[model samples]
Structures are given as C-alpha cells and as structure tokens.
Target: MFARWVQEILRSPLLRPGIRSGHRTSGIFVPVVRGSSAAGKIALLERGIILSSVAYLAFETYKWKKGQTVVHASIKVDDIIEQADYLYGSGETAKLYELLSQYKDSNDAELLWRLARAARDMALVSTTPQDEKKRLIYESFDSAKKALELNELCWAAHKWYSICLSNVGDYEGIKTKIGNAYIVKEHLERAKELNPKDATTIHIIGVWCYMFADLPWYQVKIASALFGTPPSATFEEALEYFLQAEEVDPNFYSKNLLFLGKTYLKLKNKSLALDWLTKAKDFPARTEEDIEAMVYVRYWYI
Candidate 1:
C-alpha cells in the first residue's frame, strides 16, 4: 500500500512540474517567488528528503517482491520436471512427449532437454511409418540444440543431442552417417565431461562405441570408399564405458544392463555376460526397453 502511494508520487505529472520549477542549476537559476520566506524554502527541502526516502523504499520493496516471484517460479518449474520424469519413467512415452511438447518454446534448459529426450524416446518406441519417426527424431535434435544454445553448460542437452543425432543418422547415406557418428561421439564425450557421474550418459558412450565396432563389413567398406578410412572402435572400448556406467549407477536402466551383458558376450566373457543378462532378465519389465531386455535375455539364456 505504501509502495503504491510513493509510486503515485514519483509518476505524478503535477509533482514533476512543481519540483522542476523550484530547481536551481549551475548555469541557470530561478529566483524565489517575491514574498516566499526562508521558512518556506526549508519546508520544501524537508518534503524533498521525505519523498526521496519513500521512493527508495518503494524501489527496494519492488525488487524484493520480484525476487520472491522468481523463487516461486523456479519451484514451479522443478515440480513440472518431477512430474514429467515420473511419467517418462513409468513408460508413458506418448503422454510425456505431449506434456513436454507444450513447452517447446520454453527457454528453460532443463525443460528443453527433457522435452528433447521425450521426443527421442517416442521416436524409438513408435511403430509409425519411417517418415513420422524421422520427423520426431529431428524434432528431438532441434530441441536439444535449442537447449544447448540456451545454456552451454547443460550436460543433459549434450547427452540428448548425441542420442537424437544417432537416431537421425539411420536415414543418412553411409558417408554422411559415418560423419554424424563422429559428431555423436563428440557430444557424448562432452556430456560425460560435464556430468561424469551421469549413468545414462556413460551408457550412451558405451552404445556409441559398440555400434561403430559392430558395424557390418559392407557398411565399413562403403564408408571407407566415400571418406578416407572412417573411425573404428573395439568391443573392449565399449566394455570399459559400460562398466563405468554400472559402477556409477548399478542396474539403473535395464537397457544399460543388457548392453553390459552383450558387450561382455562380445568380449568372450560368458560368465560376466550371464551375470548381467540374468539381472536384466529379472528386472521388472516396466518400460518398453525393459520388456525388450527381457526378450533378449530369453533369447540368449533360455
């Protein structure tokens, strides 16, 4: 209430003209009215001081209120993220995608990254035609790119950018796909550097290494013909990343466990492969990936 009153005084049109009329400057002066007494001048000075104090207090109060508003907004954003995460974790991919898509134009980096990831996962699990799947993947890439533009320090943005980039790579020609593969690795590495303890990022780096290592000879030949020998990796490299991911967050994602098991099998460690595969098989088949992991485990162990 007091703030509004002071603001009214500061913004009042009549107050400004009256104050300006009494002012004296270096190069110009306005003489006092003929019959104005010294006491009147003193009273005018006191009023000016009071007005100044009130204006200062009002400005400070406005700043405090603005700060409180920001804090509340931040809390609201956190709540939204928590709800989205629960939906995504519970395998409600379509709903999660729709929920986050409403915030496509949001400037918040965390929200943008989550939206990108939701889009990418939706594309992965979608049984739609190739064109629609590709469109969703591209949307994921664009959202991740926007998140990075908004905040370069957002590790999740880099992580999802790498994932969406790889998804888009599936449609590219061999040469272009190989180039995108390198870029995918670079982003994954950056994400790992920024968030070394992020199990998902670590698992993705392992997947990146595994995909390139497991590429068919024909694809490699095509890439080599188009570009001077493309980069190559080994199952050993993949195993290291997967192991690191497990160390950080053991069995967090069934897919991560499946990858660890598959990498171990590829590396000729049947015992370790069996151990990880069994864990993946027993992991509650909650999400699509978990169900897929169960199928793979049956195919391998049964």
Candidate 2:
C-alpha cells in the first residue's frame, strides 16, 4: 500500500519534473515519496541554513580585512612621524623638510605643524633670493594655520603658528610686525598653557617679553596707534622668562642664553651680562641658529 501511494504521488501532475526549452527546472529537486511534503520542507530549511552560513562567513572576512588595513595604515603613519622626528632632532633640517614636504597636504595636524617648522627653519638658513625666502615663510605660515584649524588643542600647532606669524610680519613692515605682537603673544601663551613642559614654547614666550621690553620709541608709538592698550614688558619681566626657560631645560637653546645676556645688559648688570654672554659664545654650534647666537654674543659682548 505504501509503494502504491508513492507511485501515485510521483505520477501526479504537480509532482512531475518537466524540462522547458531542454533545461531542468530552476529549483531544488526533492523526491516525491511517501512523505513528499515533509521532505520538501526539510530540503528548503537546509538550503536556507547553508546560504546563511556562507553570508555570515563572507561578512566576517570583510570586517577582518578592513581592520587589518586600518592597523597597517596607522603603523605606516607612526613610522613616518618617527623618522621625521629623528631627522629633526639630528638638526638635518633639509632632510627633514624633504621627508615632510611630501605630506604637506596631509590631514594630520602633527605632520602639518612639523612641516611648517621645517620650512621656517629652512627659510631662516636659506641664502635664497628675498622673494623666494618670503614665499617659503608664507608657505610655512599657511601650513601652520591649517594645522591650527585641524586641531585647536595641539600645542605644537599653536607654537608654530605664532612663530610663522611673526616671520611673516618681517616682510609686511614694522606696522604689521607691531600689530601681530599681541597675537603672537596670545598664541604662545596658549601653547605654553597646553603643554607647560615644552621648553621651546617657554623660550619663545621669553622672546616675546624681551621684544616688547626693548621696543624702540617709534615702534612703541606704532603699537600705541594700533591698539588702545599696547603690550608692554620690562627688562625685569624679560629676565624672568629667560630664567624660567633656562630652569625648565638647562642649556637647551643657545639663543635663550644670548637673550639672557642681552636682557642683563639692558638692566645694567654688567657682571651677569658678561657671564651669560660667555656661556652663549661657548655653546656648541649644531645648527644655524646656534651659529647665529655665537656671532651675536661676539658682536654685542666680546
């Protein structure tokens, strides 16, 4: 009886497998047996399970590949930054600039600020034409500005931006230089506030104080005309900043030593002036700035 029922079901028109255009039916084939209905349902469930597993595996594979790519990219960026820093610390400004200039359009605030610093240093030591020097300085300023825009809290960005701003003022005339004085001070203070341990930022703040303290009478008039309350500092204030910088990092910068000597001279302390000037002259000349410091010491002191 069971055999007869199976035969009848297989002979049914609904259960018959037919070829259309000499092609098999585009569907799962299930045998029409005693329990054809149940068998069909089971086959469908198995197909669904197989397809779900394949899709799950594919999705997991995609995620893993994406994660690995992101990690690799991060490591590459870190390596580049580390190499750039090494070049900079070694005082290879040209090499540092060459390495970092390739990434001038990078979105990384860290890279942009460092690139700006390299460009500024290059401009300082470059014997290029005046127009070429101006172009480089302006480029440095633009890079620093972009870095600040990308990250407001970046201490290095703020520091470089302020330095580049001051550099730009050199070509813009005395009025512009005096006009940017307060802006430069503001950014330097912000940079110091963000990272108090940065000896370079502290030293720049000291320079700011020194410049205002020794402002010429005509420039002072220009500053007065530009702002209602023009920035003012005394030789004593400049001395304090320079001393604080030295305390933070002893013998870190030759220029800082030179400024200390000059500030003491302004205050009429011949003994301290001579002492600091001697130190400045004796400081090692690793970079152009250090060489300039030695020359300044000799010209003004010895």
Candidate 3:
C-alpha cells in the first residue's frame, strides 16, 4: 500500500514541474504495517511530508534563478550607462533625459546622479511655464540628494547635488539663496577633491567665485550681515579657475568660454575678453546652452 501511494504522488500533476523523472528525492520515512487500522492516518502524514519537500525544492530553485537574473541585469546597466554617455556627448539632452528617467527609482548612485544632471539641464533649457520649470528643478534636486544618500563618495553625486541645490535657490528667497552659497561651495570643493580632472566641476567653482566677486553693494551687505565674513573672491581668482578648467579640457563647455570672457571684462582686459567671447560665439549651437552662450556673446561682447 505504501509503495502504491508513493507512485501516485510521484505522478501527480501539481508536483510535476518541480519533480522530474530521475530527480532524487529524500525525506524522513515513517514505517507502517500493511493491515493496521492506522494505515490511512500514516499515509496522509506521509503525503504531507512529500508535499513540503517539493515546495522547499521549488523555492530554492526560484531563489537561484532570481540571483542569476539580478547578475544579468547589472551587466545591462553598464551598457545603458554607455549609451547615455554617448547621447550626452552629442548634446542630446532630451534623449539622455528620456533614457535615464526610466531609472529614476534605481538604487545605483551613478545612474541617479546622471539622471539629476539631465533633469537640471532640461529645466535650464525648458520653455515651459514657470511652475513646470520649478517642478523640474526640484525633481533634479531630489534625485541628486537621493544619489548622495546612496553613495557619499560618488563625486558626480556631489557635483550634481551642488548644481541642483544652486538651481533650487532661484525659486527660494534671496536670503535662502545667499545662505546656500557656502553649502554649494563646500560640495563643489568636495567634488573637485574627489576628481580634480573634471573640467565641469572646476568651471562651476569659478562661477561661484565670479558671482561673489561681482556682488552689488547691497547684496554684499546682506551677505555680510547674514554670515559675519561673507564669501568673497577676486576676478583674478575666478580667472585662475576658468583658465585651469580650460587647461584641463579646452572648449569642453561654451559657458566656460563665456565666463572666461566675462571674467576678463571684469578685470578690464578687453583684448583677452574679446578673444574668449569670440570663441564662445563661434561654438556650435548644438543645445540650448550653446545657443544661449552665443546670444550672450552677441549681446554683451559683440
């Protein structure tokens, strides 16, 4: 009777997927007498044990397959990152944003930071209403903050976080905006320390210096009142950072060229200013930023 019960269980449709022919099965065996009145109860208990064993094996197999799938997915992430980088290099900001936005909830710090950058870029170039533009900027800031939380050591996270934080200040009051300057400077410096060769990070530091150096008298007083010794830098300091960024990656960004020109103008060096402004004007207008750079050159320097 026990042998007949075992054969019936092995042929059951419910267990077919997990238990195939020639698959070894092992479990605790409870012996039973052939003519005993308790045979039915023993058989039921035996059946329960078999079902439990099959369920356990199925769960283990599922776990193994799930792990394999995770490994494959991680490899695909690298390919996606490469594709995103190519889009960015071509100044395809819209395409880059579309691709990375799908992974906004991803746990990867690298992808999150890149997404933040794309969102911020879109916000900068967006022709949408003010409320929509503000939404995008805040979204960018959230993504950057999330990336930083995931990996404090990620330099790109620090860089984007600083940029997004500064962008958010536009909607915030001037007092909050001015207060965030020191925080922005700290993150930019941290980013520079992590990756000194990044031209964009260096360029942004120069922008910070230029902004404070050119602050009007009333704003200067506000800053000084708010934070004792307010942040200050000279045109000479801003010029040095811009030049260093250029040295690291010449013509990498049109804004850098425009700023170099602006800094020279502040220093009363018209010859150098004109040289840099002309370069900015001639830069290919592949994206909105490049177009804006050209417009600035024409308006202020031409």
Best by TM-score: 2
* Candidate closer to the true structure by TM-score (higher is better), 1 or 2: 2
| By lDDT: ranked, best first | 3, 2, 1
Tens-place lDDT per residue, model 1, 1-302, is 54344335445565443221111000100001111122333454454345443332322232234333112223355556655655543445666676677678889999998988777666654355667768887898889989999998888888777776666666665555677777878887998899898877777678777877888888788878877778788899989988898788666667777888888889899999999999898986433345545666776574
lDDT of 2 by residue, 31-99 (tens): 001101222334544543454433323222322243332112233455566555545544555666766
lDDT (Cα, 0-100) at 48 in candidate 2: 37
- Residue range 1-302, candidate 3, lDDT tens digits: 54454445545576444321121111110000011112232454454345443332322232224333222233356656655555554445566677777678989998898888777666654345677668877998999999999999998899888878877877787777777878888998998999888887888788788878888899889878988888788889889999998888778777888889999999999999999999999986543445556766776569
- After TM-score superposition, the amount by which residue 115's alpha carbon in candidate 1 deviates from its true location, in angstroms, is 1.3
| Overall lDDT per candidate, in order of appearance | 0.65, 0.66, 0.68
TM-score of each: 0.70, 0.72, 0.71
Better of 1 and 3 by TM-score: 3
Ranking of models by TM-score = 2, 3, 1
